[model samples]
Target: MVTVLTSGLASSLMDRLRRAAMKLALGEQPPEDLPMIAALALADGLESPALVELAGLSRRDPPADIRDLFTEALAELGLPMPRVEEAWIDRMLDAARAMLSGSLSPYEASDEIYWCLCHLDRTDRVTEPMLLFAGLWSNWEDWPDGRPTIEQNMREAAADLLRSHGEQVSEHE
Candidate 1:
């Protein structure tokens, strides 16, 4: 048996992924929802189906480690593995860590981060520091892309989250 070595971060991520797969399997959340469920597990309160779909679209050419883990999980669960690409999976995993750790700068924010933040905000999980960081990087100069600047969006998101949590944020404050 070849022992595959995973980095500390990878191991942590894999552990989370395994736990998520087990939970979804035990909870009867349907096998097809694995990618999204896994994404949610990897990033608390963050859900991006587009990212999951992108991973699926790239599954035909997956990395060895991803394939190994995916195959192992499916086999253990007696479920047929679905087409999920490693590249997208890795991207989603990395994004999950970045967002959760508040390491993503506004300049580095992509549609994925925006959507994830929106989801977190809706779920009342948005934090003050996260909002400040997002706002700091969110500038109108980056506008014209149709979507509002990250700062504006983050500020609004922060307000919404605060409001949902019963906090009254004054306009001046």
Candidate 2:
């Protein structure tokens, strides 16, 4: 029981720490609007035009993982996964690079990526898990050539370092 209690306390502390870090990084009282916007975009499968309108209303970025999250979520909902173009992959990679660096936070990254998807050309939008997946891919220790983007490499390195210390990534709620 003592061990369980200690573990619970540690987990709770970690949660608090993560929240504090995110809030500090955002530099503003983070609004709940971003997550809600994400949820709305995910739920409605809002087209690019609609998404642009949605972005205008958001104080934060749109759902970053809409493509992947939607794919998974829609699968569960017994709906077909929407087929966004593949060129979005490159855009996602670029966005991921920006995100990994201090140039952008995950929230900002997710927001802009979603914004581009909603407003930018068909190929210009960064679609996900591919966006997210590539960021993961470029981080491999075994990759002979360095990652095409410094930001992605940094993100991968940071994630790896954190994992080594037993830090785990959680889904955004």
User: Model 1 off-target regions past 4 Å?
Assistant: 1-93, 96-105, 127-134, 140-173
Instruction: Report the C-alpha lDDT of model 1 over 1-173, residue by residue, as the tens digit.
Output: 22223455445445545544444433333444455544543354222333233235333434443444545544443334432232223333344344334575334543334443543333224444345435444543456473445545544444444455465766532
Q: What tens-digit string does per-residue lDDT give for candidate 2 at 47-97?
A: 233333433444444444332332333334333332233233334444554
Would you estimate the TM-scores of all the predictions?
0.27, 0.21
Compared with the true structure, model 2 gives a TM-score of 0.21
Cα RMSD for predicted model 1: 13.3
Clashes within 3 Å, all models in order: 3, 1
* Model 2 lDDT-worst window of ten: 16-25
Please list the residue runs of candidate 2 whose C-alpha ends up more than 4 Å from where it truly belongs after superposition: 1-84, 115-173
